[model samples]
Target: MRKRTVGTGILVACAVGLLVYLAFNVRLAPIPNAVAALKTVGMTCGSCAGKIEKALKPMKGVAGVEVDVKGGWVLVGYDTNSANPETFAGAVRKAGFQSWLMEQMSLADFRRVTGRDFGAKVVRSGGCGTGGCDSGGCGNAI
Candidate 1:
């Protein structure tokens, strides 16, 4: 009976030690900075948006990318240290579409292009539309 008790105690102690070690060693991966969003022209259909998203998705530092055909915007999440706004634009251009890093366009413009506002809140936040308007004149300048 004493031997069984000792064995059980040892097992319990080992389990507690394992739990503590795991607790100390386990770490969550750092969340990467997202690219936020970039407004561009020439995205007129779901397939167009898909092409843009596919192009940007594999670039270094890109965590997530969403291209809205109706909204004419590409919302991207990226690791800023690994990529930047320029890189994102380049990716879109490489995909055969003209792209630029324009500020978030007006809700009216977004609606006109995309037909919906998945990124309307970002526009409302007022950080968008700060960049220069693109050649297509979908920005605040007009």
Candidate 2:
């Protein structure tokens, strides 16, 4: 009985040590940028929003993503220097949607008006009439 108890204690200690080692060694990737917003088109339903969110969330440098179907926008939080904004538009395009960077003030004001919370930093923006672009504009300046 004494030997069996000592063996169990050793096993438990080993398991605990392994868990602590793994926890300390595991390194999570850092988030790349602050919050950013992109005006999107063709996201008329929940599925569309989900598809876009799925595509963008896994991208490197992207920390978090929120898709607003009603507002037709996607807000992202990331590290600016590491994040490639073009990748965001590309993901949207791949998901069969169109997207563009909304002007800083325009996005902030829109968020305020719509009562959306993203806490974005406004990395870049397209001017007036640039929101919700289609294939003709190709997610760029017209």
* Cα RMSD for candidates in order: 12.7, 9.3
What tens digits encode model 1's per-residue C-alpha lDDT throughout 1-142?
Answer: 9999999999999999999999998653323444456777765445555667678877766656666655677776556566666778888877766778865333355456658653333321212243332443323221
lDDT of 2 by residue, 1-142 (tens): 9999999999999999999999998656555435667899766455566677788877877766777766788877666667776678788787777888763333345466657645443222332243444543324322
Q: Model 2 clash tally?
A: 5
Report clash pairs, candidate 2: 32-78, 32-79, 33-78, 33-79, 33-80
Backbone clashes per model, in order? Answer: 9, 5
| Candidate 1 residue pairs in clash (backbone atoms < 3 Å) | 34-78, 35-77, 35-78, 70-113, 70-114, 71-114, 103-129, 104-128, 104-129
Cα lDDT of model 1 overall? 0.61
RMSD of 1: 12.7
> Which candidate number maximizes TM-score?
2
lDDT scores in order: 0.61, 0.66
Tell me the deviation in Å of residue 17 in model 2. Answer: 13
lDDT value for model 2: 0.66
